[model samples]
Target: MDRLTLRLPPDLVRRFDAAAAGRGGRSRFLRRLMEEAAQAPLPAPVAATPAGRTGKLTLRLAEADLALLEAEAAVLGLSRTQWSVALIRRRLQRRPQLTPPEAVAFIEVQRELRRIGVNINQIARAMNTAVLEGTVLDLEVAQLAAFGDEIRAHLTGLRAAFEGNLAYWSDGT
Candidate 1:
């Protein structure tokens, strides 16, 4: 490959480094960006409507904020505009928005809770059958109690995760 050198401002370099972190470093990230840009079709210009809406808005962001936005959007596989619009809608609707990682965590927690529920249900059915047959199941009662404790702990952890997510959105962080 041919070598090319370009000089960039220190602040710009810092932002680039921050955005490139965990993305296979600067070179790979830059190359992927270049490839995407090359393949992406140019957006057509928007014409003004008679109602005077051009459907265009612009914002000036600080370098650090821009870097953070780009990093987050990249992680979610979304464009900055998409991310911003979702955030705005979420805020306006007073709804919580979870990142992909957060969503995955919640999904795993839900699966565990479901599994626990199934186990509890099976234990209850077995106990009911034993009772109907005039037999006592001491072991099953102990197991059911243990399962109840386990479910309580899981629910507590799940509640904490939800509260943390809510706090994050509440603070706009």
Candidate 2:
């Protein structure tokens, strides 16, 4: 690829030069900019790929704002650059508005899981009450225990569904 010279305003150039000195060489930063301009779409301000290294990409940010991004990134389980990438992706990506159909389905599933969990808990309580309050034959007790185990299996399935939904919406972040 041919290298092109970009004329920046004096202040911005000074900032970029200083930022480059803090991390690595200025050429590396320039190369990254060239790569991004080639790969990144004109509409979106962020890198299309998550964690596109832009530590040396100087944005005119207050030090406090930078610290806040770092803090938020730590909380979100990403580095500062990854967090910035996520912000960019959020801005540039034409977000798929959750379809009404999907929204309804998700809501229904959540409600059903809650209802089922409540029912399972209630049943467990009843079983406990039955065992503690009444003299239970071994066979009867075993049947109740088996039923409880079935309820537990169903709960596990609900948990799996919940996790799957979360992963599906996370968009590889």
Candidate 3:
């Protein structure tokens, strides 16, 4: 479809938006209005549909707000009821909120991970310095370097466990 660019004063724009609202937004409303104008003079605004299955939810909002709602609903090929219901359901059914105990546990796990990270950084720095200085490695540092593969594997396992617990807690698993 071709786009039309027309400039209007702020007051006229506001009036145009108000007229288009609650009746399938600017494009559809304007189309209908133009057709009506060609045939005869314009009439009063269209009344809203009944609440139907859902209970009433009436609000007096700005014309632009109404137009935005109508446009969004139309984009999904949904009536206002379906669109609103879907939005409500999506917001209501997000991941479960953490309890106090769970929140504490989560923070503790994060702290432990940071502590482990700091230890790893210290080890790496000591190892790098020993290599650069051509100094003999300490017995403990030698053992740690020898068992690096096992240490890395254990850290990877810990990370997997953390992720699993996080998903379980967040998703109510």
Candidate 4:
């Protein structure tokens, strides 16, 4: 790997950092960008189309956002505009139509479920590390096992709550 130093404008740097934060870190983000650029299809000429075949929509993005879009488009073997249109269409098509209050409640439930999952992961990791170190006493292992059971109970409740809502809209609900 080669190391390169870049001197970018402060505002651009801020935007880049923000984008990188969403994707783990700067190095991974830049590596993905380079890979995308390497694999991008050659730009093709735009041809005249029949009337009403398609319409144009223009957007102005931060440099960081544009780079991300370009990378994603490259991965999909699509032009940036085509990729954006496809993504937007899929989002609109797939999402459920919920009342504002129902939407809020659904999002809250999802967030809580995610939080519980994270907590469960942390507890499992701690138990695994203790076992690997050969320091987990019998009583401590039993406690951890009990805690795991409790996490399973919470997960069951969350699943029941989600099912009770009966708001599966994607499959022609």
Top-TM-score candidate index: 1
lDDT of 3 by residue, 1-173 (tens): 67777768999989888888888898899889777889986688888866664565656669998788788777656676665655555446653334345457667766766766677677778777666443445654665564565557657865676565345335243
Which candidate number maximizes lDDT? 1
lDDT of 4 by residue, 1-173 (tens): 68988878999999999999989799899989988998998688888897879677879899999999899677646678766765565457653334345567667766776776677677678767765444456555666677677667767865665454333323334
Error of 2 at 148 (Å): 1.8
In order of appearance, the predictions have TM-scores of 0.54, 0.27, 0.30, 0.28
What stretches of model 3 exceed 4 Å from their correct place?
1-96, 132-173
- The per-residue C-alpha lDDT of model 3 at residue 120 equals 66
Across 1-173, the per-residue lDDT of candidate 1 in tens digits comes to 87667779999999998999989999989889988998999889876567844476677899999999999888867688877865775678777667777788889988988998999898888777666332357677778889889889988998887777556556455
The lDDT for every candidate, in the order shown, is 0.80, 0.66, 0.65, 0.69
Cα lDDT, model 2, residue 14:
89
Name the candidate, 2 or 3, with the larger TM-score value.
3
Clashing pairs in 4: none
List pairs with backbone clashes in candidate 3: none
- For each candidate in turn, give its C-alpha RMSD to the true structure in angstroms: 14.5, 14.5, 16.2, 21.9
Off by over 4 Å in 2: 1-136
lDDT of 2 by residue, 4-53 (tens): 77768999988899888855679988778777889976674664656754
